[model samples]
Target: MISSNMNVTFENLSDITDDLVIGDQVFTSRLMLGTGKYRNLGVAKQSIECSQTSIITVAIRRLQSSSNFQPNNLLNMLDWKSIWLLPNTAGCTTAEDAIKIATLGHEICKKMGQEYNSFVKLEVIPDSKYLLPDPIGTLKAAEYLISKNYTVLPYIYPDPMLAKQLEELGCATVMPLGSPIGSGQGLQNLENIQIIIENASVPVVVDAGIGTASDAVKAMEIGASAVLVNSAIAQAKFPQLMAKAINLGVHAGRYAYLAERMKKLSRAMPSSPSIGFPN
Candidate 1:
């Protein structure tokens, strides 16, 4: 139901309601938050509550480490019964590593009584500095995970070709970076992202490099099906308030997109007619 016609008016778009479908699951909120980089789990919880995101991501490594199993445990703090958990292979650098992490994530989900949906965010970033996803490794891992009955959500660069290939490989959703991970660059590669959104058959989620609410707005306005924000909200001075703002921004941008936002004009066009001029 994603249309780029840009021929409709805001008044007529009031009734247009769309759900974000990833694999067999449907989410009402298009803002997908990550459980990382927050001051603490308390802040993360508050942010999650304010964001109203039905889908939240967690690194499988965190879920596996015994250190996080202590008091104020990350997973223990979350209401797993309510929100959908999307475990990611955040630190994985190879397809094999990603596949292994995804498997572990599925097993953890089973142990935690979350077996209804097994969605894993496959991220294979060999580069430590920028943490940008390796498209080849991602594609390889996605294919393997899909075969193993896991709903793969591949994190990748904003390349339309890679997006299509992932979709073809049975990825549930395609997450393209707006900029580098945690860079706060705000869609530096906007043209590429627009292309990804336009061509993707599955949901196009703008992930990483979102610095603020306006960045989220821009992402959704450019036709992103959803936005995956972590550092943007988690690192904010007031994480809870920023989360709320980001959620609202997503809603606004989504509505604007569905409303067939006004086309850009090259020249000025006065709201008042020339005949009604003061002269």
Candidate 2:
């Protein structure tokens, strides 16, 4: 059980004034960690604590069964009080399956406790090799989930049109992938992502294929509301160190965005004072 005094809605960071609003909830951290692919449970927990993210994602299927249940399981390992759990329907390949998994995710959150409230990260991928998100299945599931009033955040490709469609259907957030899942390619479809950001009324989170801290920095700098990184931290040689780096990168990028970075120049302009300096 979560502690009564634990802070779930906020984490103080003076540089950023705008909070990441998903549905009715607001989060201070722009970095959301995925609770998978870590070397060990201890490492995952340490990494998450280091990241200081308001929410961490867990797959719904893993939490439903008691077969592998133990003290080391994700639920027991997580500090449920302070961290918001955004469960994902990771393995579902069809709209129906995704819906079922999402329902289970909501039920699990309800039973466990809803400090931050129940939120579902909907993923429906049929392809195993590339593991790309199924846009059609995702849309179908998102429609159904929204009807049931679930705070649905659909994982999707960097398709601006699709993003607009999902927003129209009432999804809380639209997660556009930077690259293929776990590939570490880093913003392969930057132009499309930019379009999505430009058009989206809701939060646009850069999800998946973030290879390093720089990748995360680039995402937020390009106007993404937040980033969801898993493999970058979990697969790193030092998970905790990587996690801290990610947090820093996220803050730096968000600060840059909020501070309003300088406009792009068509030609080179001298920073030094040419009138005073030797030619």
Candidate 3:
């Protein structure tokens, strides 16, 4: 009973919808992978490929320090042409250090033939125990980076006010953590994250603390534009399989969101109409 026009429309749906735009870049995939904590460079490369992520975050400090000594380096392993680099300032504590690391990441991206890419995942995490990002330092770093024309995606706690402030400051995206970094605790601050998503003008990325495919699904279902997962994928028994599973979950969640889920009622309702049925 399907019409030709409806079939055509259904076929061309992908061409019209679900493009994630961050500043000057347009990405199809909502899942962003971090290139750290993998067992090896090969595993990381495979996971990246399996996840089908358009963007991959590289720790600039880690790459710089390990590239010289390590035979199999991350820079050489990844196919730079297809994958866009989102250089992250992970080890930096202060704004100054983060700025410096971000600058280095920019140069490294240029060297990798991504000359136009000025994307930086700004992280000014002064706290050592929880590995939480410092809001004040992140704000300072984001301001400076924005001034310098770098596309800043700052990782911060799930604070709605702070997310709005960053969006006002011309940040490309506000990446609020679901929980403590590498904790695999999932979305601990769901209410705050929802508030951030509701108020944010820019893309709200749920970064850090994702444990499994369900975590990614929860994040996406709750209206997060994207999710950046690292430890969960890297530390898994099968990184490639986990990556594939998580990618599918991300797609499922996104589609479910776009489909406009049915509203929840206070009381249960029967599927069959009561008046229509004859006893």
Candidate 4:
């Protein structure tokens, strides 16, 4: 399924498809992953290669260039052109900071030959403890990002109405939190995600709090456009193995969506009952 060497087959079935188009970029894969917290750069690359991610997220922070050591010592090891490098404003506390950081990221990506047609994950997490999104700041940042000709993907809480609000503000996609960031809760807010997915015209990418492949499948089962996952795979003991699992999960989820989920069972049909037996 990935680069012609993976021997993969599908089993689950549903009616939803996973092809996501953001601006000029069309992604066939629904599994979006993060490029952070791996044991090492080599392992990270291996995980990504195995995961077959379409979009990979990286967090950016301000470095004290003139402070302690030479700024040239900074390391960014990932190859930008190999994948869609999504720069995230992970620790931005305010809307202004978010806008400024995103603008710099947009320009930087262009310098790296990643093209101006890049995506910036607008995250305005005011709290460090809970990692909860600051909706007010997030909305403000979304508006500015939308006006700046950047494809915006704002990570937000599982508030259906707020997701719609962001969608109305010209966002390319609305990323509702699956749980909390790094919580690994896995569809804890299923009702709200379903609501957002049901109403969104743009892609609804489940952004955070997914623990396993089953969680991703559950998100897709409810019509999510795609799922953005990070810690669940990256923090695993064998990240490469976890990546493959997640990849299979996303593929299965997409295929299931396309094949149509089976109807819920009300009463037992009884394979061998008093009425009709095979014997």
Candidate 5:
């Protein structure tokens, strides 16, 4: 269980004054990890611990089909008290399929003793090649899920209009993809993502396509509330090390954002005053 003691201490970094508020819950860590694509469950567990992430997203469909759904399964191994389970509707193509998967996700949460946890990472991706989410399907599914009292965090393309629509529809957060899922292309839609962040009242979580620690840093520096990383860490030669790197990047980016940045200039200027210098 995540207690006050488990909260990561940011020494010398006192600028961060607020916690990441999603729905009725508050998370100290802004780096959310995904429990997938790992060499083994042990690696996944170690990576989660190394990342210092309080929230972990699990693909409900994948979990259901896995042979490890026994008494000593992945669910049983996790320290659920401290970790927040974000069951995602992955592998669902249509609104109806997503809704069903979401329902199942809720059940999975309940089984894990989170009866009041209604959070679902909503994804409706029909494009197999790109793995891009379907805007229409996402909206429809989000509406239905919200009506059912689910705290939906919809994954979507970096479309400001669509993001606003989802936010207005009672979504807990608008998760705009930085790029294609598992592509590791980094933030390809910076402008649109910035627009979404600027116009959004809810938190904007940049999901997917985070290749390096720098990618995660850039996302947070640009005012993203959080980021969801999966393949970047899992596919790396050293998953645990990558997790630590990503965690540090998140903190650095958030600190930079809070500290604010210097303005840009078209031309170079002298560092020292010309009048003070000896002629």
Candidate 6:
């Protein structure tokens, strides 16, 4: 509910550089929005616009022909041509299921766009309570998808060792969760996240568990390449305004990081000179 803009001076603003290059595409906005939890399509579109996010993620599900809702039919309501769709395998638990979902998503992208080239959020969460990503299964899935030549961005816990393995497996990006999915806990493992950011060779996107603009800012301030947030915005009372606030937060975070923050010292300084003078 709070505005992202506060105490930020954009004097030497960082140019929105195309740092995130997935396959042949590059993204400027580090703030990635999820297409789930919005009450309506109109609100989703508005939030996307406000976020200035060129790439947004959406979850895919099998639609029965007899069902009232449709697959691409719903996606079509949005200006799909303007934004890049990153389909996530949210419900997949096994490696096989994840591969199948990736294949289906590739086919769908082919039908939807001329390039037919978009990244996949390869998520393999077995448990329902914690929604923790299965590192072993995730690596298997990422290896398969990367072999298939699909840009893979696998979401995992903030574990540097796991991140190294996934990066070695040829994932386009390694996305680590701030906490649990939709938990809004926000950067529970700051130390591990810093390690991931430090050692990662690829883009490190902090995904899930962010509850506010400040959370997003904190992630970016620590040098995360990007962030993915859904509940903090979509579940808010004013989704559009929340989206704008998030955008500003991301911008503020980016500016702060690029400024290369000053060093910290332990000693306290006296405002007045310590030297005594005759009065």
Choose the strongest candidate by TM-score. Answer: 3
Q: Rate the local accuracy (lDDT) of all candidates.
A: 0.87, 0.87, 0.89, 0.79, 0.91, 0.81
Q: Answer with 1 or 5, whichever has the higher TM-score.
A: 5
| Ten-residue region with minimum lDDT total, candidate 6 | 1-10
Kindly indicate the candidate among 4 and 6 with the higher lDDT: 6
Error of 6 at 91 (Å): 0.5
Task: Provide the lDDT at 279 for model 5.
Answer: 75
Cα lDDT tens digits for candidate 4, 1-279:
121222345443333334567766877577899866777767887888888888887675642233312433212545555567788898899999988888777765765577665589999998989999999999998888788788899999989889999999999999999888888889989898888977888888999998888898888767787888889887888889988988888777765665577778998775555755466
lDDT, candidate 5, at 133? 94
Q: In model 6, what is the error at residue 267, expressed in angstroms?
A: 3.2
State TM-scores per candidate: 0.91, 0.90, 0.92, 0.85, 0.92, 0.87
Query: Stretches of candidate 2 above 4 Å error?
Result: 1-16, 274-279
Q: What is the C-alpha RMSD of each candidate to the true structure, in Å?
A: 3.0, 5.6, 3.9, 5.3, 4.2, 5.2
lDDT of 4: 0.79
Model 3 over residues 1-279: C-alpha lDDT tens digits? Answer: 111112224566665357788998988789999977899878988999999999999888876764443546777777888889999999899999999999999988888899999999999988899898899999999999999999999999998889999999999999999999999999999999999988887889999999999999999888889999999999999999999999999988876776668999999999877996668
Clashing pairs in 5: 1-81, 1-82, 2-82
Instruction: Give lDDT for model 2.
Output: 0.87
Q: TM-score order of candidates, best first?
A: 3, 5, 1, 2, 6, 4
In model 2, what is the error at residue 17, expressed in angstroms? 3.1
* Candidate 2, poorest ten consecutive residues by summed lDDT: 1-10
Better of 3 and 6 by TM-score: 3
